[model samples]
Each structure stands twice: as structure tokens, then as C-alpha cells.
Target: MATPSLQDGIDKSGSPIELLWQPNAEPWLPEVVDREFTGWRQEQAAWHEGVALLNLSHHMFDMWIEGPDATRVLADHGVNNFEKFAIGQAKQYVPVTRDGNIVTDGILAREGENKYLLSGIPAAQHWVQYHAEKGGYDVAFETDPSSAFRPGGGDPKLFRYQIQGPLAAELVQRAFGGPLPETKFFHFTAVTLNGRPLRALRHGMAGQAGFEFIGDWEHAAYVHETFLKVGEPLGLVQVGARAYATPSVESGWIPSPVPGIYTDPELADYRAWLPLFGIEGKRPLNGSYFSADIEDYYVSPFELGYGKLIHFGHDFVGRDALLAAKGSETLRKKVTLVLDPFDVRRVIGEDQDPGFVLSYARHRVESGDGLVGVTMQAASIDPVGSVLALSLVDAEHATPGTEVTVVWGEHPGSGAASEADLGFPRIRATVQAAPFNEHARTLYRRDR
Candidate 1:
């Protein structure tokens, strides 16, 4: 018999949004290896000044889609235009509901003529597989679930690592023992490292020049150790999970959003198909932006600042809805919230207050009288001398100097009752450009 999912025993009597905040709920990334190898502060510095290497083989899952109709299946389900997606190129794959609400976004790469790899959150992958099986596509899929899902699932099919910083290219050149191949942003090339085949993708999480090196699991240790040996003089710091999450704020990448797949009548069948223990079923919505209607939580790609990736040239799911929403006057825009330095200190200083704690994840952002938006990720990038958060706000309030208030405490019914009972704390914040780091906006996509 299949093991009952975490949601099997959940009390479904309340609104779906409320059930998400139950104290017993597990985090979306439950098996996150949260630790700082060289310390988080230093790791943050490494990404800016030197080079930072991150081990991404465990936390995120990977799905392989291959067969003659692989590209067709992807083009049908994703909002991105696959017509020009070359084999060596990768793009951010965004899957949406028929109503144009974003389901989830992840990294998709075409490995060969009929082979593709999708890596990131499991929710999007599951959606793709369901369609592939039911749509009668001539495609096959193999998934390497995350460690949290299959504790002893054995060695992963691939080992993933990211190296990013000003010196990243130099380190790669030295490791390859020659000039590094010229690769465009989001494109990759094959190279040999220590006599082993390695595919290096020109990508970066921190919005700096970098490469993502991936290969068979067997070569993981060899590749990591070799890079460390060669990178010793280049100030290479191995980033841990804690620091690994900080870049999203600096790079303007929204890491977590409640997958907008629930409450749509048309998607009832898809919801039924998802395992209760899967990411979609168990992920919680804990921020202060509470709403009885689940639709209030749904977001479109354009609202998330992915308008450039949307193409209406071909018909696809949610194409019509996106077309109508494109350039709409009420469209939400992404921005960075520079939290008031003094107010931030107050929240951290309140540690002496009994049962007081501040949450840095998915806090609610509001204007004077109403909730205008919510923050997706927050971090203290000390090197930048300000606590930063990424937010999607009403266009009118998204100006670089617009002021807003961020609810800093947990919801009243979320997590532990004692912690939840404490009223929400408010912090002053000012809206800024989404890519808070100037280098990310200007130099991020420039080819070396």
C-alpha cells in the first residue's frame, strides 16, 4: 500500500489557505542542508568579491523528458517560445493554468534533439508529467526526486554545482587548461574536467558572471575536489544553503511563491492527481496577507516581471488570458524593499521580549491603509549595508522611492499558537529596483 501523505490526516474543513498554516506542516524544502561552511557573512562576500561554489545536487529535484515529441509537449504546456530554443540553450520554463495564473517556474534545458532536462521545484515537473501522460505525447520521463522525498533513493543521476563571482571565468579557464569556450547567457557548452565530461552552463544565481557545472553523479566528488584545489588561490568559498538563498534578493529572483494551482475549477482534476504529500499539497502559506479566497494568492508571469519570456505567436494553455493581461494598467511590478535599518534592528532587538520572534520568509507588504503586495524573499546582505526583500507591488506604489510597511511577525493562526498569538510587527521599507545590485542589472547578461 502507498504511504499516506501528510495531507491525508489534515483537517480540510477550513479554507485551503488556512489549512496551509497549521503548526504541524512541514516546510517546502524540508531537507534543506541549512548550514554555513565558511560562515554566511563570508559566503555572501565571496559571491560579490571572489567566487562562490554551491552544491545543488540534493535540494532541488530533476526531471528528464525525452522522445520525439518532447519539445512539442513543452511548447504546449509552457509559456516560453520553444521555436528558437536551441539544444545548447536553456530558458526559464513557466507553466500556467488555463486562466493564465502561474503554476510554477523552473530551469529547462534542451540536451539534444529529442532530450530535455527540467530542474527546480517539483510542482512544475509533476504538472508536465501529468500532461505528457494524458496528452498522448510520444515522450518518456525519468525523475530523480529530491532527498527529502526519497531518503535512500541512492545516488542521483546528475551532480549539480554552481560557481559565481568576478573570478569565476578565470577559475574555469585555469581548470580547463585553456581559454574557456565563449558561451552566451543561458547557453552551455561541453568541456572536459580532470578527463571527465562536464557540461558548463553560463548561468548565475547571484547575478554575477558564473557557470553551472553538471555531470554524472559518479564524477561529483572528483569535480568538486578538483575545483576546490584549483580555486584555492581564487578565493573560492563553498556556499551553504543559508547563504545560497540570499542571492535571490540581490539578483531579483523570486525563489518561493505559493504555486497558484489550487481553487480553479478547471484544475480540479489536476489537483486530484497530485499526491497529498507532494510539494503542492504540503507547502504552506504563512505570510500575513491572509485571504479567504485562494485566487487572491494567484499571480501571473507578467506580475512577476517575466513579461519578456511570454510570447503569443503560438497557441498554448493560458495564452489568451496572458494576452489580455499584457500591459494592463493594473499590472503588478516587482521591486526591492530596503527595510528601514533602524526598524530592522528593533525587530532583532526584541529578542528579550518573551515569545517575540521575527519571520524573514514570505512576510506581508502593505501600504498605509491596504495590503498592496507581499514579499517573497528577505535577507540581511550586510555587505550591502541594508536588509533587503523582493516584493511584487501595485504599479502605482512600485516607484524606487515609494514607502511601504512590511508585516514582520507570523500570522495569528500560523505555526505554534503561542508564537502566532503575538500580533504582527510592522517595519518601514522603501521600494527600489528589483535587481537591487547594480551589477546584476547591467553586467549580468553581458557575454564575457
Candidate 2:
């Protein structure tokens, strides 16, 4: 029997928007680990003051791409500069549609000779795999779906753990019993802890100096235990799923954007290859920013503050269109919105959600001038002590401290004016610079 594809599901749903705007079984992070170890608030502060252990083994999808033409397959699809990508380095790989609309972004690391691993959401993997198969590239892929979609309840192929915060380096060195290797920002080095081989990527999701340790599943327990024991005195707290969702809120990374794959006639074949059960086929498009046109939800990479990653020197998918979009005044600028405290008391009450539903809703952001932007992901960050919302708005309103309003209720059918219903109806907000953490914005990217 032929496997159901995204195209089949969309056909039955009537439109791509209908296929996308349905209930989803997968929320951002599944409950593989406890939602909290000590308390969400304490876990939230760990990464800021001391160190944090993040169990990322279950939530993200990983795809291993290898073979003679692996690099070619990536170069033909991604907008990142290949000349600078070397073994032990990584990039925030951004893939786009032929029209230059963003498909999604993933962390792509060059792990071996002519081999790479792309990790994060499934959107980029699906896109790259389809193109590779169609182009007949001499490349192969082995996928490890996030625990939510992994078949059977068996163990994952790899285990990923991240030690983050200002004191992450101290924790890592102490655990390793030696001075850590000199690693550049976004670069990784092979290291052995308790005689088990692992790759430690210098990454900072919290916008702090940190290391993401990736290794074989067999050695996962050893690494976890070693870190827990070694990091106890240093005030390391294990971050649960509850607090895990808030890191990106302060880091300025927008994790989800509607991929621009659906509704494009040119991508019909691509859609047919996408599984009906995959994230692309079934993820819910909740929130107030709605249009019958699926294209309305599509975002350009430039709009999400990824213009620097687009390498014009390379000819790839969406190159010509992106070249045209480079300086266009219509592109939206991503910013941080600090929800008003007075309105919080009046609307949703004092106990704002601590990222319980981070990227689920697409709330509408407006100004007195009229509709200006859309809030992508929002959460109550303890460190910031504000309900920070990541939004994309007009250039004119992108400045810090610009007053705006957020309609806090979900529209009935997720359409613009479907209906009004929620705990809170409206809340006022102020535009601010993204990466609300100064270290994240300035010093986090530096390799000291």
C-alpha cells in the first residue's frame, strides 16, 4: 500500500491551510523527562546564575547526511556559506522555497568528512531529502525522529545533553577532569568522558556560553550521571521541559515559522513525498494571525533576522528571489515585545504562564496606526521578570520602547475575526530589542 503523503491529506482537507490548522498530537516538547525537577522557577534561574543540564535527547530530530555528494546536496539547498563550514563547526541552516519564503531553520554540523548531521525540527530534513532524491545526488540519510514520532518506545539512536549558562565551561572542565579544548563559537570538538566518546558543540541556546554534548545512546547514562555528580556543588540544576521552553524566548531565536511548502503549484511533487503523519502535514496553526491563504503565514528568512546567513555568492534555491528581497522595505523585522504589567493584572491575572504554550498561538500585534506585526512565540521569563513575546513587525515599529497592543485571545477558528474567546482579551505591550539578555546579544557569540 502506498504511504499517505502531505498532498493526500491536503486534498482531503480542501486546502493546505485546512490541513495545517488542525489539532496536533505533538506539542513542542513531549513529556519524556519530568516537567520540573526542583521547580520551574529554580530551573529557569540555573542557566542564568550557575549551570543547567538540559535533556535534549528526546525532543529534536536528527538526520545524518553522508556520501560523496553530501556537501553538494546541502549547498544546493541551504543559504549558509559553505566555504567557511569545516569539520567540527556548525551553522544555523536556513532553507527556503523557490520564492525565498523560509521553510525553516535547523542546526547543521559538519561532523565527518563529506558528512553532516542536521538536527532540530523535521521541516529542513524533509525538504533536503526530497531534493536529494529527486536530483539523484550521491548522498544518503539516516533519520532519528524526535521521541514523540519514534517508532515503538525503544531507545533513541543518540543522546543529546546541553550544559549551559555562565559557568557551563567550569562544569564541563570539572566533569572532564582536565582543561577543555579551545573551541570556537558554534564549533565542536571530540571529547571523551568516563571513556565514552562524545562530540561537544559550543552552543548557547540561552544566549550564554554553553556546550551541547552529543554521543551514542549506549553511553548516555554515564554522561548524564557524571554531569549530575560533578555539577552538584556548582549549583547545576536539571532543566525540565517546563523551563526548557523559555530559553529561546530570551535568546531571540524563533523556533517555529510556517513552512512555505504548501499551496505552491511548483511544490506539488514535494508535498506528495511528505508523509501525511509528519510535522509538516499535521502541526496546528493556532493563533489570531490567520488568512485563508496559507501563503500569508509564510515568513521570509530576512524577516526573521537571518539576512546575514544568506550567501548571495552561491546559487541555490530561492537565490534570485532573495537577491530581490535583500533590501525591499516590505520585509518585517523581528523584535521582542514586553507585555505591560498593568494590563497583565487586568487581563490574564498575575500568574502569567511560564511558557506552558510557547509557540502554539500566533497572537496578533497591533498599533494605533493599525495592524503592524504578529507575535510568534511568547512566554513569561522569570529572569526577565516580564512576559516577553517574540514578534515580527513593521520596520517603523521595530524600534525599542514603541508602544503596541496584543490581542490576547485566540480567534474562534484561528481566522482574523472568527470570534473572541479567552481568559484575557487584550494586553498592552512595548517593543524592545530581541535577545533581551545583554550577554546573549553581545558576548554569547564570542569565542573567548
Candidate 3:
């Protein structure tokens, strides 16, 4: 398929918010503030040229959860306790169905003592509503469907830029004047750039030590331009969504509208919010498909690599179900698969390409009568000597050295051209532990 493109234009009558797009660039909102100094499209182009700068257009959301029982309200959901989350601290987790199926993965922030910001898939709103109804808590919510990161009211829109990699910090510090000496991972400190107040967070979705800056749209152009001055000097090129998504997969972060293993009413609500949240659309982008039947899409927490994070101490959604099934019934397990180097090379049609093979939800041809379990996310051509993938497999299939077939290429030939065809590659592989790229990620952030 040809590269998707949308032109930048102003929407004066439809909504007060203004948007800009280039015929050749990925669709963006709030307008491209600075064409010369900082263009998200230019940043995307840099990724193909060796360096990477990702726009992160869909992975983010802006929302607010309010009401007196807000804290208790969220607790009733699958979110970990909010009490431990100090003001300005961010927590990430997946919202599970009453049946314990994964509904949506979200990031929550405590903006006020009684109010919180929940951003991720719009399906998260259903979980919030379900909690309010069941817990009888007077809670409310506002979904910022467009993940625009606007700070302060005067600015109609917001723009954020993330600079990552080994030299990301130095380049960012140069743009802000002096150095951003005191920012910690997942923590933010406010600063003024080009006469506009901005918040800089030492956050990296790409698993690299990086910085994300948030500010109003009016000042986006100036802010973007300023970054280029520092970025160009430091050889920091703009990366695209593809480059950034690599780390997310390697880290086992599933995209929104996570499929669940069990069926439930929450599935309908989840479907309603899919388009609003930007997870599933008319044209599917990734390997996962949207299922109207919740049963076909249930995801056990174990399958999501959250088995260790599940604490049964407090009363929360799916608490009883999860606990009751703990001892007796068997729960699904999530495991990683390491592909043969030869097969990996053939799959992407690249000889010794450093880029990893992205995981997809489509059925994978494996070995034996046992079918390949749901492959949630994958990253190939890893620096860690193998192509890795995360999969939710049956109890028998979840084990180290479990001989599994990856199905690299279809029927006859197992080469680059055959792998690129619409059909399966069908390469043989084996099941291992969770987190295929944990080692490499740890190496990247050794300092922090």
C-alpha cells in the first residue's frame, strides 16, 4: 500500500481547534507550528535515514476523572491503588473485565487530590463507568479523544516533542538553555521556553533515556525550532512511530483495546470507544483485529506479563474472580519466543538488519497439533542475538525450550520474497520467559 497522507489545513467552522497536515505527512492536529525549525514529518523522515524521531501520535491520551469518590472509584477498577501515586506521579496498568479479560491499558496521573487524569484507549472510559455504577460512587469523566497535550487555557491546542537516544538529554538541554539537570524518569519539572511555560518529563516510550516536552500550540513552532538548533548540532534526527513502537513491543506494552480471553459485557463498551481512542479504525494498521465478541478477545493478566504485578491485598475489580480461580483452575501464561536468526533475516527480507520483527495478532503457524497462541507483540533483529515476541499460550505450551514452530515463510520457499507475501512465513521457534528485550533495555538506561 502507498504511504498514507493527509494535507495540513485549518478547520475554522467545525471546531474552534485548528489542525495542520501535509499531503505527505501522517495526519496531525493543532497544526504544525514550525515548518522549518521543527516538523513532525521531518522527524519521521529521519528515522528511515539512520536516526529516529517518533511523533507518538496515537499512543497518548488526555483525560480527567473527577468526583468525591474518585480515588475509591478508580480503586474499584483494576488500577492499582492511587494512594501510593503522589501528585504528579504517573502509573500505568491495564483495566480488566469483570471476567478478568484485558479491556484497555491506561496511564493514570493524579492532577488533584480528588481528580485524576486517565489516558490510553478510550475504552478505559467504560471501565471507569462500570466502577462508578458498581461501587455506587458519584464519579465523572472527560475524554480528550485527540491526545493533544495542552497546558494552560489560553492555548487552544497543545504540541509535545520527544527527543530520545544516547544524546537526547544533551540536545534537549541545549534547547531549554543551560541544562535540565534535575528531571527523573516519569517525573516532570516546569520550565519556560521562548516565553511559554512548558513541562519537561524524563519519560521515554522507546525504552531509551529520553525527554518529552508539553506546551501550548501557539508556542509549538518556536519550541520545535529551538530543539532543532540543539538537535542538529548533536546529530539527533527525528524518528517515526515505527521506530518508537519498537521499544513498546520489546517492553511487552500491548496496544489499546487489548484482547481478552473470556467474554463479557465490557467488550461492547470497549468496542464503542475503540474509534474514539484511536486503537481500531476502518483501516487496520497492525496485526491485531477488533473483535465485537468479547469472548474471542479476552486477555488474562498473566498473558499480559502482569502476573507478578497482581496484588490481591485490596478489594478491586475482578478480585474475587481472579482469587477464586487462582488455586484450582489453570490460568493462561504469557511467554516470549526466540526466532532462528536465518528465519528472522528471511521474514523482513533484510540481511543482517538491526530492526526487530514486529509482533502481530494474526494466527502464527507453529509446530505440532497445538496451535500457536495469541502473539501479542514482537520485536525482531534485536541486539540481543535473537528475534523476540510476546505470546499468550496454553499451560502446556508455556515453558522454556518448548519446541514451537514460528512459520517464517509459506509452504514452499523460506526466503525474503516469500516472507513478504500476504501469507504466513511459518518459521520454527521456541517458547521462553517473558520480556524478550529486557536485557537490551536495561543496558540503555544503566545510568538512570
lDDT digits (tens) for residues 279-310 of candidate 2: 78877786666667788889999998899899
Better of 1 and 3 by TM-score: 1
Candidate topping lDDT: 2
Candidate 1, residues 184-276: lDDT per residue as tens digits?
A: 889989988868998999877667888899999999999999889899998899988777767888889876666777776666667667777
What is the C-alpha lDDT profile of model 3 across 93-115, one tens digit per residue?
Answer: 55666676666777676767888
Alpha-carbon RMSD, candidate 3: 9.6
Q: TM-scores of the models, in the given order?
A: 0.92, 0.95, 0.71
TM-score of model 2 (CA atoms): 0.95
lDDT of each: 0.79, 0.85, 0.55
For candidate 1, what is the TM-score?
0.92
Model 3, backbone clash pairs (residues 3+ apart or across chains), number: 23
- Cα lDDT for residue 352, model 2? 50
* Sequence-dependent TM-score of model 3: 0.71
